[model samples]
Target: MLPPGKIPPEKLREIVFNRLGAPGERVIIKSDLGVDATAIDFGSSVLVASTDPITGTEERIGFYAVHINANDVATFGAKPKWFLVSILLPENADEALLAKIMDELHESAKKLGVAIVGGHTEVTPGLHRPIVVGTMLGEVSEEKLVTSNGAKPGDAIILTKWAGLEGTSIIANEREEELVKVFGREFVERAKSFISMISVVEDALTANEAGVDAMHDPTEGGITNGLHEMADSAKLGLKVYAEKIPIREETLKICEFYGLNPLALISSGALIIAAPKENADDIISALEGKGINASVIGEFLEDKDSKVIVENGRERPLERPESDELWKIV
Candidate 1:
């Protein structure tokens, strides 16, 4: 059986990355494990594109499809402009369901000022639920483009929002009955509302404005894994302070109830921004000015092979996250 969540990077390198046809000269950022989007050089500007499939969430799948894919491009300091989506419905799908998805897509695209240029829809032979895969394209001035590989040693590692934001919302919405019994209806409802926080476009844009060396959104494997990806791309080591990482009360209760590691859960809303030590505070202030909470969690190291997570007075090596903690309960 295929593994749940993301395919391991090692396997992806051996089977996918290593086999890709040589890229053209216009290709600025090619396929890489940590790099979020591909960049193509276009004279005065660079076109960035990112694609992701929304199969993990049942509620608001279309909305998630647009925002999630657009987020990748925004992390590169690009303003999303166009979207292409492939909506695949199960054999049992109906007209009403299709309309619902389309409405969501339209609403989300409008909110983000993105145009839905083209897409394909089909009722496939799949025996289960619906899926939406979206491709987001955006442009950025050549001088303003940023990549995950730009993180430098001694740069402060900044993180925005709390851990498990998307996962918490998904669990609350999809598994309301189980959660309500333990956390009560009010708390569960509050957690479910976190779905609206799943987009990191604002955080990314603000960090870009404030000047950042690198930016990465924590998604599948949450912040810890996101940090590892940043290090891998930058060819540097990292030391993350566990205590500095924020976790909401609702996330704590839910993760504890499900026996999941909050840090290892899917966290779409959170962004990991690497900036010079002097600029880190300004970046944090800029994000908070826009109503986003952020903090400096750690700094990059000169040793490219080392990665550590420190808590209290003890420190330990940071292991690569294998799977998202959300899969356990979902």
Candidate 2:
């Protein structure tokens, strides 16, 4: 049986990616391991589309569904303009539950200036909880289109925000009573507010404007998995400093309580950017100017098999996490 999180990359290549029937001629980007969104050639502009489902937490599922998919499109240097959702409820769900979800979806979409174009909603059988699947669409000019495969060997890798951001919020919300008993209501509430930082649309756009060869939002499997995906997609090796990667205090305490590796948790608010060494400083500066914390945590290397992380002056091979640390707790 497969793990509870995303399918392993090897299995994905064997069972899923290799099984896609006929390839579309207009598809500029096809299904791949690291690439989250697909681009279709449409004359002067390319249409970028991405889909993601929220099943980790019941709280703010609608908000998560919208921003998570939107983040994928924005990582390709596109502005998400239209959204579609499929809401599946459990058999015993009530109208109040659906109403709350719809309200969240509407507020989130409006905040992002995206239109809810169309979708389907139904009560699914045998489901224990509600699941919201969202698809986001955006357009970008051919010249401005950026893909995850564009990172070069010498480019500097930049990381925005802190690691394990989404997982921290999910844990705080899902385990509120337990956490509050140990850490008090103030700390738990602060951790829960991490949900507000779940979107990386601004981070991607600012970095793209400052000049980035590649950009990716760290979703499931946190920043470590995200860095691995970036290197794999670019066909390059990377050396990142463990000390340079930021982790908030709330996340640290919460992870310690659960014996989880923050770097291996789900991270949505953070972004991974690869840019030429010469432009890295400017990119960081632009992101910081917009009040988004960013740092050059590493650099891609010419050796494709040299992925490593430097900590305390020692180098260790960076292992790809089998599953997100969030699953162990929530």
Candidate 3:
């Protein structure tokens, strides 16, 4: 069986996506690997939709449920407006736990200016913890719609914020006691606060306005797999500079302690933008001006087979992560 992360891109294309039914003209963007959201034409505007499930950690699960799905829609240069979630409660769950989850959902959605229209909630047997699956709907103008496949050769690949943001928070929250012993309470608490950085809506919209060709939020497979997804979707290659990739101090310490690669951990707060080399700096500045850290990690190459990571003069093929490094500890 596949491990607990995103399905491999190849199998997803062959077994799952290949079976998608044909859509009429209303479908602007159909299901595709690496693509974040699908779009349907609605005359004046395009309705963008994305769905994601939150099952990794129980702490802040409600907040994660909304942000993860909304982040995908935002990557399409859309503003998330409506949300629907499926809440599955574990057996023997109490009313207080359910109330807490509902309150979190409401607070999270309200913060993002999204409405929780409707959803189904049920108590299931043989479950250990609660799971929230969210579907987000957003809207974008026709000209502003961006897809993952829009990246072109010679485009500079820019990463906003730092990698492993989500994984660090999850680890700190889920294994606080274990981490506190090794890294002290202060460090663990700082790492746990990274959950506040999970939303990339502003980063995505800023890059879109700055003439970015493609935008993606690295989720399950982290930055390494995120780059692979962009390259795969665009049918291009990437030459990433390992030293150029942004890694936060807290993230580095946490991953080192856990013996996990920070680059291959789930990172929802980071935004990947591919743009023309000439416009890359402006895009970076735009994001940084908003208190978001941005860096040029690499460039898209002409050769489709060339996915290289240059680090300290050494070269290596940037392989797609089979599963998120978070799974190792979680």
Candidate 4:
């Protein structure tokens, strides 16, 4: 067998889908393009459930766990109502650290109006610092469910926030000592605030209100990966201008220091909204009115291959979430 990191993308796809199985009875696989979350249909309402572990990074794992799953559910235009969290602290972890994590988790969840329900936890020798996993439960009306596959040929794609926000943040926080010595202390300090912008709760709600056809948060992969997945899910193409892509100052610094493509990293808080051309302005207005920075990145096209138009009038196929550069830095 191949090493864990060297596993083929297709094989990993099989592992995930095989575990997902086929949708039956009360569960509907509903747009399983390795999108953020899964939904279960019960009666007239659809309940979205998504869980993710936060063992891989050090900075604000508790905060990330709360927003990440809720972002998944909110992508469907659903309001997050409940969250179940599991925090497994290492035996030797300090009580202050544990308290800080729990406090951050509760504060964020409460702000989002998501009640902490039920989960399990234990201290074990196998653990390192602490692992926090959260599952968010949200429900949407039957008529308004927007799948990642809902983007149409003529839909305009609007990207919110900067690209590679999460990946850059992780690298900055985790490699602070090295980055400070190499790239100066000011540059290193600037890279860490990317976490403050780590929630799509506003983006999702505003987009839905402004008549967005479909919405997705750019998480595991960056903006390009998200657009590719959306286009493929809808069996369409994306015509985007890479020059217009938003990149944060901190993100640019991190990408430059790490020799990475800013567009191919992780961005948990960014949202991509696909809407009709007429409602594009409305959506942008709604987003900007709420003080959320967004831009008209591109539009969906009829062409089969998803492409991003770049510098000097060149174009290339968009990046999908095959092997993210996030792993390289994080």
Candidate 5:
């Protein structure tokens, strides 16, 4: 069943069309709507817009809110330029909490040289908790516009960073009290630090610089889902090596405890880019130079049928993710 506050990505998309009429002239949706960001054609520059709202884990909400939208724009091969935020707080919300969130947003934006041009805030009964919605604007040259659909046959699949980083971080933060009581404080503390691993600005830029054809950030649906979308959008097939994907010691420990697959969990800070086989080495090295984890997990095949090769040598067809159990565990 769908959660009370959450909507399926498709249903949410239908609502968008229902309001805006047919997306034409003004909109150029290269990939499926509701995936990361939307790329709008603007002649010389492609305008990419992404709006993400922060909910659930409220402690580091502001920090994640900015990066989440920024990452979406980055995946489109754009430099995040502007932000428009919408902040809603409960009437009884503490002033200190609001101040802290604003401060965090400002600092993060400044680091990327992004300006918060305008936004609105309100304290009302309609909101029981704090919610921050960040809408980002970025520009990508038409020549360099990256799409999830840009994957090509024989392109090497490169995944950077540890798996399940975002999911593990959310779980630890949202359930810190219980986690500490059950999983030990050290583990919880380590997991919370995953917050710093939440930037895609470098990952996408470096991959594009290395002449990558496609870029996708694993979010909401995890790496497995991310790979499927990339292949599906490109009308291509992918071969994945389960053993080659990176999984952090902490992320794996928590996944094993919860009986979850790390690769299928949401990982925002990490990005998957399909680079020409010749550029794979330079791409990985560039990302690593910035102290980021990067790896070649597999490659695209001319065969339209996609499959993931397990560590045991078994093969399984890639499936469109029906649901993300990420929220359940975290």
Candidate 6:
């Protein structure tokens, strides 16, 4: 049987992506492991679309559904304008639960200046909690379009925000009773607030304007998996500095308590940018100027096989994470 998290890349290629029946002529980008969103040629502009399901935690599922999907469209240097959602509730759910979710969705969409176009909602059997699957749509001029495969060798890799941002918040909310006993209610609340940082729309747009060859929203498999995906998509190698990767104190504490690797945890708030070495500093500055923390954690290498992370002056191969570390706990 397959694992509970995402299907392995090799299996995805062989079973899912490769099985897409016929390719459309106007399809600018097809489904792939590292690609964030799909682009289709539409007259003078490119239409970008991405969909994601929120299943890890129900704490802020509605809010998460909007931002997470929007982040993907933003990664392609597109402005998300319309949203569609499919809400599946458990048989035990009530009207209040649906109302709470819809309220959150409305507020989140309003904050992002996106309109809720249409969607479907149903009470699904055998489900224990609610699941919101969101699809975000946007358009971008051809010149402004960006994709994960655009990263070039020798380009600098810039990271926005910190790692395990989403996982930290999820753990705090899902296991609040257990964590509060160990670290007080205040700390848990602070950790839970990490959800507010889950949107990377600003980070991507800012980096794109500052000049970036590629951008990716680190989602299910965290920073490490995201890096691997980018490299794979671009067919390039990379050398990352372990010390350069940022991690918040809350994420560190929560991961340590569960003996989880923060680097392999789900990281939605962070963005991965590939930019020319000359533009890396400008990109970082632009992001920081917008109050978003960013750093040059690595650079692409010429040899496609040379993927490694330097730690304490020692180099070790950077292996792709089989699954998100958050799964081990939550």
lDDT (10s digit) by residue, model 1, range 213-322: 99999889898889999999989999999999999999999888888999898999899999999999899999999999999999999998889999886899988778
| Candidate 4: clashing pairs of residues | none
Model 2, runs deviating above 4 Å: none
List candidate 3 stretches off by more than 4 Å: none
Q: What lDDT tens digits, residue by residue, belong to model 5 across residues 1-330?
A: 566233555676676536754557757664363356788878878899988888756777778888999998998889999999998888889889889899999999999889999999888687777899999999988878787778899999999887788888987777789778877999899998998888989899878877998898888668887887778667788898888988888788777777777777788888989989999999989988988879899998877675565667878876656655476664
On residues 121-213, what C-alpha lDDT tens digit does candidate 3 reach at each position? 999998899999999999999999999789999999999989999999999998999889998999998999989999999999988998989
lDDT of 1 at 60: 93
List the candidates' TM-scores in order. 0.98, 0.99, 0.98, 0.90, 0.89, 0.98
Q: lDDT of each prediction vs. the true structure? A: 0.92, 0.94, 0.92, 0.79, 0.82, 0.94
Give the 10-residue window scoring lowest on summed lDDT in candidate 2: 142-151
Lowest summed-lDDT stretch of 10 residues in model 1? 1-10
* TM value for model 3: 0.98
Tell me, by lDDT, which candidate is best: 2
Ranking by lDDT: 2, 6, 3, 1, 5, 4
Model 6 misplaced regions, further than 4 Å: none
Regions more than 4 Å wrong, model 4: 1-9, 19-23, 28-31, 182-186, 306-308
Candidate 6 at 62: error in angstroms? 0.6
lDDT per residue (tens digit) for residues 118-162 in model 4: 887667687767889899999988676767677888888898888
Clashing pairs in 2: none
In angstroms, give how far residue 189 of model 5 lies from its true place. Answer: 1.9
Report each candidate's C-alpha RMSD, comma-separated, in the order given: 1.0, 0.8, 1.0, 2.5, 2.6, 0.9
